[model samples]
Target: MKKKIILIAVFVIAVAASVYLYAMYKPHRDITAETADFTVSVKQLQEEYAKNDTMFNKKYMDKTIEVKGVVSTIDDAENGIVIDEKLSVTFNDSTKKEIAVGKSIKIKGRLLTYDDILEEFKMDQASVIK
Candidate 1:
């Protein structure tokens, strides 16, 4: 009985460790390949978040979304862009050179956070759609 119990316990431990390792090593979601959950302009998303942040946060948080606006600023060091002075998006492709200031473009990314003090929305793993 003692040997049987010891064997079962060892089996359980091995299974648990395997499960944990698999989960930890699993690849992250590719946001660029995934479809956007919502599509809105920079103005609309910023206004909605400003009005009721908690409600919108529950709705938009951690979800992939697409936003359209003109590029207001480009940070080459960060490989990112601010749209309409309200949304900040960091692109996955550091070599992307299609964007320019004052040019209208569409981008898809996962909504990361809303900075109420700055009144801006931040996204990551972004890709240019237009």
Candidate 2:
């Protein structure tokens, strides 16, 4: 009877530990080497998301994407650069580039979200196309 009880306690502890680990686990996504779910111009992306946000989110959320646009602003801002004043592509510190305003460029990034008030799309973990 004592052995049975001890076995049950151990089983319970094991299950609880497994549950905790599963809860804490967050797998990272590698954008490189993966085909982009969508390749779009910054202006088109902004317009699509603005017109039908729910559909846009369903298609682009948490996915790697490539965007082509002319840089409208670049500075020390943490919010990334504006694309024709319609979108912002914030770069990760490690992947940041020395890009100038008015330069045509393509960038790869994870589509984070859209801001309605600003009428802008935001990307995170962005890297400039070489």
Candidate 3:
């Protein structure tokens, strides 16, 4: 009788532990899926940069985000690539692999708040979606 009770208790504990772990590792729902990708023209992007640098700064500052645009240039040395659109951004090397000039792509990356030498927002570790 004692052995039976101990076995039951052990089984219960094991089940409880498994449930807790599964709950902790569950995938989170993606919020970006609901919002449509922002699309802007290259000329529009340049205008916005000139008109409201601060607002542009606030929109992209240090956030993990996705943007869709046309590839303009790729700089392997700096690991950077540029997207020509309403919000022109330079993505680092990792992003370059995912994009090429004249190709339209969706880039997900962390937007660096600091201004680059080119006066463009630096996008690091960008993942490009064809």
lDDT of each: 0.90, 0.80, 0.62
- The list of candidate 2 runs beyond 4 A from truth reads 1-10, 22-27, 77-79, 94-97
lDDT digits (tens) for residues 1-88 of candidate 1: 9999999999999999999999999999999899999999987886788799889999898999989999999999999999999898
> For candidate 1, what is the lDDT?
0.90
The backbone clash count of each candidate, in order, is: 0, 0, 3
**lDDT value, residue 88 of candidate 1:** 85
Q: Give each prediction's root-mean-square deviation over alpha carbons.
A: 1.8, 2.7, 8.1
Assess candidate 2 and give its TM-score to the true structure.
0.78
Let me know the TM-score candidate 3 reaches against the reference structure.
Answer: 0.48
Q: How do the residues 12-57 of candidate 2 rate in per-residue lDDT, one tens digit apiece?
A: 9999999999878966666665678889987677677779889989
Question: Per-residue CA lDDT of candidate 3, range 1-130, in tens?
Answer: 9999999999999999999999999985343343323444445545666788789767646656667677777667766667772334544335444467888877666656545455655555555544
Candidate 2 local Cα displacement, residue 1, angstroms? 6.8
By TM-score, how accurate is candidate 1? 0.86
For TM-score, the strongest prediction is 1
TM for every model, in the order presented, reads 0.86, 0.78, 0.48
Provide the lDDT at 97 for model 2.
50
